[model samples]
Target chain A: MLELQGIAVSPGVAIGKVLILDREGYRITRSQIDSADRHNELDRLRTAIAEASKRLEQHRRDSTEKIGVDIGAIFSAHQQLLLDTTLHREWERLISDSCYSAEFAVSTVLSRYAHAFRNMGSDVMAERAGDIRDVERTLLEALGGAPLQVSGGLGQSILLSHDLTPAETAGLDRSKIIGFCTEAGGPGGHTAIVARGMELPAVVGLGSFLHRIARETTVILDGFSGRVVLQPDEAALKDYRQRMEVRAGRVKQLTEIRDLPAVTQDGTRVTLLANIEFPGEIAASLQRGAEGIGLYRTEFLYLGADTEPSEEEQTTAYREVLSQVDGLSVIMRTLDLGADKVGKFTLLEPESNPSLGLRSIRLSLRQPRMLRTQLRAMVRAACGGKLKIMFPMISTLHELRTARMLLRQVIDELAEEGHQPPQKIQVGMMVEVPAAVLMLERFVREVDFISIGTNDLIQYTMAADRSNEYVADLYAGHDPAVLRLLQTSVDVAQAAGVEISVCGEMSSNPITSLLLVGLGVRILSASPASLPQMKQALRQVRLEDCTQIAKRVFDFDTAREVDAYLKTRFAELLPEMALGV
Target chain B: MGIHMRPADLLSRTAGRFECQVLIENNGQSIDCKSIMSILTLGARQGTQLNLRVTGPDAQQALDALCELFEQGFDESDSEVATEQTS
Candidate 1:
């Protein structure tokens, strides 16, 4: 029995036969079309396309019922690509000209398309090829019998894959699969998102186990810690058993707090909002008691579309969300595309450091017509809804002013078109850029409110890429620069008589939220999954000497110092751990 | 006929590769189903078909949307999305 310890990202346990998802590179090599018969090969390719389309349509049917129309559109778009004439023509040309096998042609083209993207280019364009390849490979796998067959009736097996691609993970039967452990993948990988969505227990980047842990080795996965123990000893068994009991108790406690208001023990009213990427998560957010959507990312609208969404389509999306979460404030950030959302979409330019490029309001201002169109759509949708507009990555008052000018232009257009627009739409900026936080005093006067986007702020502050496993040690959320920024943003906002809050990961962290509220943040936005715990944590403490603590933290240099401080403070404040008990 | 070019261009034009007559109306709205800028903003991609049931003002644009798919092959650019779209 082998025992291994790694980071457990998702939480769950499964003991079953290991079904390894194969690497696309090797599979492509094996399935290279080798026949000299051209006509027969064409026929084979066509049949495969038909099968892929049929399966995609079926997936659309199944998921549409579960997720809804937008997700359905994603599958439908894949099906449409299957009938793409250019793709077929390319395949024919490759077969005729290069004389390579069919599978080889697909593998080559898709791989070329997939790798064509520079991780630091225009996010929309950078992602275009991958999205295209994703579509291509989905079709190719159907043709080659590579992906679909891998999923056939393994019956609730714990997926052991060399590396599970996004498509394979999405294709997984979440009901049967208790968890997944992969040799390759990271947090930002699509596999991670799919697993998170499916709520499956997953631990990734576990080097070579297909040979070491033979089939059905009865492995256990700890998603919370990224730990995998094979054939545990008596002590390990007792530890996990006791851990399970604690988890169950925590679950019960959290569930009870889900329906409770996220208020501090001192009766200070703080609004809990959901920061989400898709409209699909809204239902879960509302179900979990989110006052409304703090950050409604517009990327998904662009991400899954075979084409850009029409103004009408954009309107429909905005309206649907507003109507569903009626009476709650919906803060909309326009096109927060930059270093992370790399793709080629024609309007955005490719940049070296996209993190500091013409993103957010900068991109929108460059494409005034596009920005105006989105704003018009959003404004038109806000006939009587509680909607506010937010500009991300704003570094100066000039950017904020320009973004608002465009907002006014959109409003004027709507008014000129005789549409009854909202009486007022509050303007806000995400204090995501360190420069923005530094300029909060000046910015607070210009915007009605502020949201601390801790993700980028931390990255920019520490100059660390949270996605890099090697540098993750430096990407601590509690680092002094990050905490100082949070504290300053809150203080600046309060002094300006403007509302300030953090809608970042720190806000969702049950422990960090203590520090956040301690710094005067009244609006906390985080993923809905973290809401219950945040609520439970908030109920544990009243206002204390946050000024002194913030001062101490700001003076500290490392995350370890901040973490140690928090641990000691938390242990002191809640000795029983009763809130999350 | 569609010209085969790099799709990674943020401004690849698509004016000729679509069905000029078949306008698939996007339910009660005026939309150019084919403009590259239109496609980009709408977030269209390789497999996203432009069914041009669009008529009236932007009918020709609808055809452009379909043909754009044929004209531009995929290219990589750098612009990471900070957040995904939520409903």
Candidate 2:
């Protein structure tokens, strides 16, 4: 039995045979191919790539909306490269000129392209190699002329590999692919997105997983926590079965609550919105009945792109988002880039501490062009939509004033340029830095609304790095300090009579959400996937109950104590709520 | 020398390389360089360490980075956990 641990990109549990997508990488058999076989083999390779392309398109059609069109388009690109006459011609010439076999020439050309693609000095470019490698593999498979099946019969085992490409993933049969584990990928990667969309349990980024896990072994896949148990004991199997049934039931229940309004038993109605980083997630949020988009992270536009998007490019993206929400309010935060968000070439110098350095509003003020371009795009897109501009990492009143000044300046610029100004859209601040919380009253006066960015707020407030797993257990959202700030911020927002919402990782966390509600945050926004569950939990507890429980939770000394106390109180308070409660 | 790690173990051996007893993010196989914010995103606070032995093409460099982040010499003050929740 082989056991390995890795990040849990998607959540689920399954027991299925493995499907390894091992690229017999590119190989040269040290044999000279006759001139006759070279053309024939090249033709076969072309055919295989073409066939793979068609299958990818079909997979796109069959795939539910969760798996993005990008995945399909990636396959489509691989198809083009495989069938590219230039690449094929190069291979042909290399074979004849170098006196090498078809396999040798193909391998040489493929490796050269792969290496060049990987050395592009960007993560996005490096990732493109994954798709290119798959194309090379497909061509190789065609030379064998045996129908390669990634997934087949029930007893037939996994197609385990170092990694699975978009093409390889599209080719796998749903029924036979009980679960897939990879030695590479992350929660944010395309594979996890595909797995979530396909309702498949996947444990990815487990290095050398194929070398460890045997073929055809009845392995238990725990996608919930990204665990693969091989040849499990009876007790383990039973536990997994029960867990599976519960998950299926939970999903069915959550789906049922899709269109249901998030109302409390006591008749208090609250808006549950989605905090989205991309335009693609908008549909999923609407499907889950999110009242609006509370947080449309604009940072993504600046990140991973070849260059800072032009004002036109930013406008196009912003307009697409505003148009899609369909009358729902989209509270868009301006570009919150810093040392972490800058493109590789743009990084001037590495800082000893980036989070503490000039970032967010600070960085934006430093690089006014990037910020202005985004603001112009946002303001332009705000026409005929309930859009608001939010500033992230606002610490002092001067920062807020400067941001507001820029907004007014932009509005005047639009008026001068003969452009009809968009809505006098609401302005907001992300209460992340502790100074922002301390000057809550001042900010309340300056901005239209508030959304507590708890992730940064917690890290900066606790003076602990949230990314350092070593100290992960130390950074507490429920700490007296965090609660003290939250309590004051929420109270200040209420006193000021501006609407307050929370859109952060903690907002999605059930315990934190409860405390937030108790602290007087009426609008709870998080990932749409967590909305139904949040709604169900919200329905079980009253504002008064939540407030009281939150008070108790904060008073606890350690996170362990707080977690334990909350769980016990939650069960006692909301018995028969959801099995989870 | 290659340090073993689960690709998904965000706060495992390599994850501990950041901030030692303090806190930091696990970038690729270890702490994210260029920006502490990237490490902050990892949300690692549980006191996880540089388990992989320091030796490789960039071993000394990696160790130097670790030492700098952890504030080498571990003065009780440097390694001190803020016992009280500061508001």
Model 1 per-residue lDDT tens digits across residues A1-581 = 56666545555555554444434522332222334666676777778878877888898899899999666756655555555555677777766665555665665555554554433245555655555666666766776535534545555666666676554555566666788888765554445654654557888877765434432345667887788876566777677778778877777777777778877677877789987766777888887778888888775576556566789999999988888886788998888655555334645555767666777667777877777778888999888789898888888888889889888988887789888868899999888888888778889888998888887788888887655556756767798767777777877888889987788777766777878877878788877776777777677777663334555677677889889998777777766663332
TM accuracy, model 1: 0.65
lDDT of 1 by residue, B1-87 (tens): 111123312222232243342322222432343332223334333343433443345445644553444354333322221211111
Q: Please list the residue runs of candidate 2 whose C-alpha ends up more than 4 Å from where it truly belongs after superposition.
A: A2-10, A14-226, A230-242, A339-345, A575-581, B1-87
The parts of candidate 1 lying over 4 Å away from their true place are A1-4, A8-145, A148-213, A216-219, A229-249, A343-352, A545-548, A575-581, B1-87
DockQ for all candidate structures vs. native: 0.02, 0.01
Model 1, position A385, has a per-residue lDDT of 87
Per lDDT, the best of the predicted structures is 1
For candidate 2, the per-residue lDDT at A408 reads 84
Q: lDDT (0-100) at residue B9 of candidate 1?
A: 21
**Which candidate should be chosen as best, given DockQ against the real structure?**
1
How good is the docking of model 2, as DockQ?
Answer: 0.01
Per-residue error (Å), model 2, residue A64: 50
- Candidate 2 chain B has its poorest 10 consecutive residues by lDDT at B1-10
| Candidate 2: tens digits of C-alpha lDDT, residues A1-581 | 55677666556677755544444333222324456565665565556556665765565455525576545545544554554545667877865565445545565577666676566555544555565677667666555422346322345343345555543454456656666777665443434544554545677766654433332356777876778786577888898899878877877888898887777677777789998777877998898779999988787665546677888988899889988999989999987766445543355465778878877898888877777878888888888899989999988888888888888888889889988888678999898899888889888887789998887888888887654434555567777778788888888889989889888666665666777787778899887777777887787777778778767876776767877787777677666542453
Query: Residue A167: error of model 2 in Å?
Result: 19
Error of 2 at A179 (Å): 8.8
